[model samples]
Target: MESTMQLLNKALSVQRAAAWVEDMNLSKSAISMAQKRGRLSPVLAGNLAIKLGENPEHWIAVAALEAEPESELLTRLRKAANSWRKL
Candidate 1:
Protein backbone atom coordinates (compact mmCIF):
# COMPACT_ATOMS: atom_id res chain seq x y z
CA MET A 1 0.00 0.00 0.00
CA GLU A 2 1.23 3.47 -0.85
CA SER A 3 1.13 6.30 1.61
CA THR A 4 -0.99 9.32 0.70
CA MET A 5 2.11 11.40 0.74
CA GLN A 6 3.79 8.98 -1.63
CA LEU A 7 0.89 9.02 -4.02
CA LEU A 8 0.74 12.75 -3.75
CA ASN A 9 4.39 12.88 -4.60
CA LYS A 10 3.87 10.48 -7.48
CA ALA A 11 1.11 12.64 -8.85
CA LEU A 12 3.09 14.72 -11.26
CA SER A 13 0.06 16.83 -11.98
CA VAL A 14 -2.66 18.35 -9.90
CA GLN A 15 -4.95 17.22 -12.68
CA ARG A 16 -4.00 13.65 -11.81
CA ALA A 17 -4.85 14.12 -8.15
CA ALA A 18 -8.07 15.96 -8.93
CA ALA A 19 -9.11 13.27 -11.37
CA TRP A 20 -8.36 10.64 -8.70
CA VAL A 21 -10.36 12.49 -6.09
CA GLU A 22 -13.35 12.75 -8.40
CA ASP A 23 -13.29 9.18 -9.62
CA MET A 24 -12.49 7.53 -6.28
CA ASN A 25 -15.39 9.30 -4.57
CA LEU A 26 -12.88 10.41 -2.02
CA SER A 27 -12.05 13.65 -0.35
CA LYS A 28 -8.49 14.86 -0.51
CA SER A 29 -8.09 13.67 3.08
CA ALA A 30 -9.56 10.28 2.28
CA ILE A 31 -7.21 10.01 -0.63
CA SER A 32 -4.50 10.85 1.77
CA MET A 33 -5.48 7.97 3.98
CA ALA A 34 -5.77 5.69 0.99
CA GLN A 35 -2.28 6.67 0.13
CA LYS A 36 -1.27 5.56 3.60
CA ARG A 37 -2.01 1.86 3.91
CA GLY A 38 -4.96 1.91 1.54
CA ARG A 39 -5.56 0.06 -1.64
CA LEU A 40 -6.26 1.71 -4.98
CA SER A 41 -9.18 -0.10 -6.57
CA PRO A 42 -9.49 -1.09 -10.19
CA VAL A 43 -11.79 1.83 -10.78
CA LEU A 44 -9.23 4.16 -9.30
CA ALA A 45 -6.50 2.47 -11.27
CA GLY A 46 -8.55 2.80 -14.45
CA ASN A 47 -9.11 6.47 -13.75
CA LEU A 48 -5.37 7.00 -13.36
CA ALA A 49 -4.78 5.05 -16.53
CA ILE A 50 -7.26 7.23 -18.35
CA LYS A 51 -5.51 10.31 -17.05
CA LEU A 52 -2.28 8.84 -18.45
CA GLY A 53 -3.78 8.42 -21.94
CA GLU A 54 -4.38 4.69 -21.80
CA ASN A 55 -7.68 3.09 -22.70
CA PRO A 56 -9.71 2.87 -19.50
CA GLU A 57 -11.12 -0.49 -20.49
CA HIS A 58 -7.68 -1.90 -21.05
CA TRP A 59 -6.48 -0.91 -17.62
CA ILE A 60 -9.78 -1.87 -16.05
CA ALA A 61 -9.14 -5.37 -17.31
CA VAL A 62 -5.64 -5.32 -15.85
CA ALA A 63 -7.02 -3.97 -12.61
CA ALA A 64 -9.45 -6.86 -12.34
CA LEU A 65 -6.70 -9.42 -12.43
CA GLU A 66 -4.08 -7.39 -10.63
CA ALA A 67 -5.78 -6.45 -7.41
CA GLU A 68 -2.71 -6.23 -5.27
CA PRO A 69 -0.26 -3.39 -5.88
CA GLU A 70 3.43 -3.26 -5.15
CA SER A 71 6.25 -0.88 -5.86
CA GLU A 72 6.91 -2.60 -9.16
CA LEU A 73 3.33 -2.38 -10.32
CA LEU A 74 2.96 1.17 -9.17
CA THR A 75 6.19 2.07 -10.90
CA ARG A 76 4.93 0.55 -14.11
CA LEU A 77 1.69 2.43 -13.79
CA ARG A 78 3.50 5.63 -13.02
CA LYS A 79 5.75 5.22 -16.02
CA ALA A 80 2.86 4.28 -18.27
CA ALA A 81 1.09 7.40 -17.12
CA ASN A 82 4.21 9.55 -17.28
CA SER A 83 2.80 11.91 -14.72
CA TRP A 84 5.59 14.39 -15.38
CA ARG A 85 4.71 17.37 -17.53
CA LYS A 86 7.09 20.08 -18.74
CA LEU A 87 5.85 23.53 -18.11
Candidate 2:
Protein backbone atom coordinates (compact mmCIF):
# COMPACT_ATOMS: atom_id res chain seq x y z
CA MET A 1 0.00 0.00 0.00
CA GLU A 2 1.20 3.47 -0.80
CA SER A 3 1.90 5.78 2.10
CA THR A 4 0.32 9.22 2.14
CA MET A 5 3.73 10.72 1.41
CA GLN A 6 4.02 8.46 -1.60
CA LEU A 7 0.61 9.52 -2.86
CA LEU A 8 1.44 13.15 -2.32
CA ASN A 9 4.79 12.78 -4.07
CA LYS A 10 3.14 11.13 -7.04
CA ALA A 11 0.50 13.86 -7.39
CA LEU A 12 2.22 17.05 -6.21
CA SER A 13 5.50 18.69 -5.39
CA VAL A 14 6.41 19.52 -1.82
CA GLN A 15 5.50 23.14 -2.36
CA ARG A 16 2.20 22.22 -3.95
CA ALA A 17 1.41 19.80 -1.13
CA ALA A 18 2.02 22.49 1.45
CA ALA A 19 -0.11 24.91 -0.54
CA TRP A 20 -2.87 22.34 -0.76
CA VAL A 21 -2.81 21.79 3.01
CA GLU A 22 -3.11 25.51 3.46
CA ASP A 23 -5.96 25.67 0.95
CA MET A 24 -7.74 23.04 3.00
CA ASN A 25 -7.39 25.38 5.99
CA LEU A 26 -4.84 23.10 7.63
CA SER A 27 -1.35 23.98 8.71
CA LYS A 28 1.39 23.33 6.17
CA SER A 29 3.09 21.45 9.02
CA ALA A 30 0.51 18.71 8.48
CA ILE A 31 2.06 17.83 5.16
CA SER A 32 5.53 18.05 6.59
CA MET A 33 4.62 15.74 9.45
CA ALA A 34 2.98 13.20 7.12
CA GLN A 35 6.07 13.27 4.95
CA LYS A 36 8.32 12.77 7.96
CA ARG A 37 6.20 10.04 9.50
CA GLY A 38 5.11 8.41 6.25
CA ARG A 39 1.49 8.42 7.36
CA LEU A 40 -1.63 10.52 7.65
CA SER A 41 -4.66 10.67 9.87
CA PRO A 42 -7.65 9.00 8.23
CA VAL A 43 -9.52 12.26 7.83
CA LEU A 44 -6.60 13.92 6.11
CA ALA A 45 -6.06 10.87 3.95
CA GLY A 46 -9.70 10.88 2.86
CA ASN A 47 -9.55 14.56 1.98
CA LEU A 48 -6.28 14.16 0.12
CA ALA A 49 -7.61 11.21 -1.84
CA ILE A 50 -10.63 13.26 -2.85
CA LYS A 51 -8.42 16.10 -4.01
CA LEU A 52 -6.41 13.63 -6.07
CA GLY A 53 -9.51 12.08 -7.61
CA GLU A 54 -8.92 8.76 -5.85
CA ASN A 55 -11.26 6.72 -3.67
CA PRO A 56 -11.52 8.26 -0.25
CA GLU A 57 -12.61 5.04 1.47
CA HIS A 58 -9.56 3.17 0.25
CA TRP A 59 -7.23 5.82 1.59
CA ILE A 60 -9.16 6.11 4.83
CA ALA A 61 -8.83 2.37 5.36
CA VAL A 62 -5.16 2.45 4.48
CA ALA A 63 -4.48 5.32 6.85
CA ALA A 64 -6.33 3.59 9.64
CA LEU A 65 -4.37 0.41 9.08
CA GLU A 66 -1.09 2.26 9.07
CA ALA A 67 -1.88 4.04 12.30
CA GLU A 68 -2.10 0.77 14.17
CA PRO A 69 0.44 -1.94 14.89
CA GLU A 70 0.41 -5.04 12.71
CA SER A 71 -2.14 -7.72 13.45
CA GLU A 72 -4.61 -10.11 11.85
CA LEU A 73 -7.26 -7.39 11.69
CA LEU A 74 -4.91 -5.07 9.87
CA THR A 75 -4.17 -7.76 7.34
CA ARG A 76 -7.82 -8.44 6.78
CA LEU A 77 -8.62 -4.77 6.45
CA ARG A 78 -5.77 -4.30 3.99
CA LYS A 79 -7.23 -7.02 1.84
CA ALA A 80 -10.64 -5.40 2.06
CA ALA A 81 -9.22 -2.03 1.12
CA ASN A 82 -7.48 -3.53 -1.89
CA SER A 83 -10.71 -5.18 -2.94
CA TRP A 84 -12.59 -1.93 -2.53
CA ARG A 85 -10.00 -0.17 -4.67
CA LYS A 86 -10.76 -2.56 -7.50
CA LEU A 87 -14.36 -1.38 -7.49
Candidate 3:
Protein backbone atom coordinates (compact mmCIF):
# COMPACT_ATOMS: atom_id res chain seq x y z
CA MET A 1 0.00 0.00 0.00
CA GLU A 2 1.13 3.54 -0.59
CA SER A 3 2.23 5.50 2.42
CA THR A 4 0.23 8.58 3.37
CA MET A 5 2.84 10.83 1.82
CA GLN A 6 3.17 8.69 -1.30
CA LEU A 7 -0.57 8.80 -1.91
CA LEU A 8 -0.44 12.55 -1.48
CA ASN A 9 2.38 12.88 -3.99
CA LYS A 10 0.24 11.38 -6.72
CA ALA A 11 -2.26 14.18 -6.35
CA LEU A 12 0.36 16.92 -6.60
CA SER A 13 2.92 16.40 -9.29
CA VAL A 14 5.55 18.95 -10.37
CA GLN A 15 3.37 19.71 -13.37
CA ARG A 16 0.31 20.20 -11.17
CA ALA A 17 2.18 22.57 -8.93
CA ALA A 18 3.61 24.39 -11.91
CA ALA A 19 0.13 24.78 -13.28
CA TRP A 20 -0.88 26.31 -9.99
CA VAL A 21 1.79 28.93 -10.35
CA GLU A 22 0.78 29.56 -13.95
CA ASP A 23 -2.78 30.10 -12.79
CA MET A 24 -1.51 33.11 -10.91
CA ASN A 25 -0.25 34.73 -14.15
CA LEU A 26 3.25 33.31 -13.94
CA SER A 27 5.35 30.69 -15.67
CA LYS A 28 4.98 26.95 -15.20
CA SER A 29 8.77 26.91 -15.22
CA ALA A 30 8.78 28.79 -11.93
CA ILE A 31 9.36 25.45 -10.21
CA SER A 32 12.92 25.15 -11.51
CA MET A 33 13.39 28.76 -12.51
CA ALA A 34 13.24 29.76 -8.86
CA GLN A 35 16.31 27.71 -8.06
CA LYS A 36 18.18 28.30 -11.32
CA ARG A 37 17.24 31.94 -11.50
CA GLY A 38 15.82 33.47 -8.33
CA ARG A 39 12.74 33.62 -6.07
CA LEU A 40 9.09 34.18 -6.82
CA SER A 41 6.74 37.10 -6.30
CA PRO A 42 4.64 37.42 -3.16
CA VAL A 43 1.33 37.41 -5.04
CA LEU A 44 2.19 34.22 -6.86
CA ALA A 45 3.46 32.66 -3.67
CA GLY A 46 0.32 33.58 -1.77
CA ASN A 47 -1.91 32.33 -4.55
CA LEU A 48 0.02 29.08 -4.47
CA ALA A 49 -0.90 28.66 -0.82
CA ILE A 50 -4.55 29.09 -1.68
CA LYS A 51 -4.21 26.51 -4.45
CA LEU A 52 -2.92 24.05 -1.89
CA GLY A 53 -5.78 24.87 0.45
CA GLU A 54 -3.44 26.71 2.76
CA ASN A 55 -3.57 30.07 4.44
CA PRO A 56 -1.12 32.62 2.99
CA GLU A 57 -1.06 34.48 6.30
CA HIS A 58 0.48 31.46 8.04
CA TRP A 59 2.42 30.17 5.05
CA ILE A 60 5.89 28.87 5.77
CA ALA A 61 8.87 28.51 3.47
CA VAL A 62 7.65 25.69 1.21
CA ALA A 63 11.11 25.14 -0.34
CA ALA A 64 10.21 24.17 -3.98
CA LEU A 65 8.29 26.74 -5.95
CA GLU A 66 8.82 30.16 -7.51
CA ALA A 67 7.73 33.09 -9.69
CA GLU A 68 9.24 36.46 -10.55
CA PRO A 69 8.28 38.71 -7.65
CA GLU A 70 6.36 41.78 -8.84
CA SER A 71 8.18 44.25 -6.66
CA GLU A 72 11.26 44.76 -4.53
CA LEU A 73 9.10 44.60 -1.42
CA LEU A 74 8.13 41.03 -2.29
CA THR A 75 11.65 39.93 -3.13
CA ARG A 76 12.18 38.62 0.37
CA LEU A 77 8.90 36.70 0.19
CA ARG A 78 10.28 34.24 -2.32
CA LYS A 79 10.56 30.77 -0.80
CA ALA A 80 10.07 27.20 -2.05
CA ALA A 81 6.75 25.44 -1.69
CA ASN A 82 8.18 22.28 -0.04
CA SER A 83 8.18 20.15 -3.17
CA TRP A 84 11.81 19.55 -2.31
CA ARG A 85 10.99 17.84 0.98
CA LYS A 86 11.11 14.08 0.70
CA LEU A 87 12.14 11.17 2.86
What order do you get sorting by TM-score, best first?
A: 2, 1, 3
- The digit string of per-residue lDDT tens for model 1 on 1-87 reads 122233334543555656767765777765555466444556665566666665556555454534554668766765664432111
The per-prediction tally of clashing pairs is: 4, 0, 10
TM-score of each: 0.40, 0.75, 0.38
Candidate 3 lDDT by residue in tens digits, 1-87? 112222224325534755655556656675455445434345544455566665544333332222333665445443332233331
Residues 8-74, model 2: lDDT tens digits: 7755653477578667898858877887888888998888788878888878877887899989987
Estimate every model's Cα lDDT from 0 to 1: 0.52, 0.77, 0.42
Better of 1 and 2 by lDDT: 2
**Local lDDT at 8 for model 3:** 24
Give the candidates in order of lDDT, highest first. Answer: 2, 1, 3
User: lDDT score, residue 68, model 2?
Assistant: 94
